[model samples]
Target: MNIHEHIEKWQVEDGVHLFDKIKLPDNSVLIDFGCGYGEYTISLALSKKHSTVFSVDKDERMLKIVQDKIESHSITNVRLIKADGTLSIAFPDCYSDMILMYDFIHGNTQEKLPIRFKFFEEARRVLKPNGILSIAPFECEYLRDSSGKRRRYSLGMLISEIESYGFRYSESIDGAVHFDYYHSPYHWKKLNGEMSFDYLEIGPVMNFYKQK
Candidate 1:
């Protein structure tokens, strides 16, 4: 499918339901960290018009795609920010009500772990006290660390890591849709061919609250 098809699938179908399941409060301030192509960003903005959504990504090209969608959809609630997720977020302390880190964490190399820790620190810094921090580790599995030793990336391990950064795990939803540069199950039905499974990728959507 093309970009248009992907956008429709995300904004109209999967992404909307996913956000709804996550129960994003209306009129809350949200930041989509490492927002790729603004799939979740656009979906959330359209779903909750009263809310302010910040679509942040380091790549300008991806932000441009989001911008076009925003203009086409006449969406006014989304603000685009170009920033590296590993570094500081361009927001005031305790600013946002929630932060979404979907399909963003992977590769537990020694070098990458520190960067992720920094990102988590930023997430904690920008979120309001007791604010929500939702994460979907789409590629959570066995990974080789810098020592060349295999480490299993389980939900428990991830929860512990985030907890160490001052977040308390609240809840987790299983079989959460993981959207990225891949076709959804709906795409296969369009071609009169059923996909082997429901979704191309599914993972746990873990919600946490920032410690005061």
Candidate 2:
């Protein structure tokens, strides 16, 4: 599918429902961390006219694509940033209403944990009190530690890791496609079938909140 088709599916077909399920505030300041091609960034910008959205990525090329989209649509509420690293996020403490970490947590090697850890710490610092921290680590793979051993991080483990950085686990939302980057039979079952489950170990997006 072309970018236009993908954007349509995201806005009209699936992505809107996903953000809706998460109860994204209509007038919040959102930072799309590691935003690739501005899928969630653009959707959230259009999701509410009063809200401000920042699309952040390490790749200039990806940011350019999002810039093109924003300009073509005349979306003034969205901003683009080329990430040098998490330390370069540039937002002041408690500045944003939410930080989005979607499809971006893979490739965490032992040597990379400190950097990723700093990223999470930055996420915590930038969010306002009671601000949301939304994460959907779609690549549910084993994470490597300093010793080079791989550890299979379950949903609980993932939550624990995030909470270790001073955030509180809130809730998880199911049945919404994660920007077409993630899908699971678990969500499909709950959406189409009679299966009634409060939470799935391997599906949906996880949510957290900054307590302080």
lDDT per model vs. reference? 0.77, 0.72
What are the runs in model 1 whose C-alpha is more than 4 Å off? 1-7, 84-86, 107-114, 143-150, 181-199
Tell me the number of clashing residue pairs for each predicted model: 0, 0
- lDDT per residue for candidate 1 within 1-212, as digits (tens), equals 65456547668666666677766567789999888877778788877778999999999998998999899889999999999544787899999998988887663445433345667888999999999898887776764443555588777887887999999999987745566534445566664664433335767778999999
Model 2 segments beyond 4 Å from truth?
A: 1-7, 24-26, 86-88, 108-114, 146-148, 175-203
Q: Please provide, for model 2 over 29-125, each residue's C-alpha lDDT reduced to its tens digit, 9 standing for 90 to 100.
A: 8999988767677667766568888889888998998898888768899888778764556789899888888766654454545345667778888
Question: Distance from true position, residue 125, model 2, in Å?
Answer: 0.7
Instruction: Give the CA lDDT, 0 to 100, for residue 42 in model 2.
Output: 67
Superposed Cα deviation of residue 91, candidate 2 (Å): 0.6
| Candidate 2, residue 205: lDDT | 73
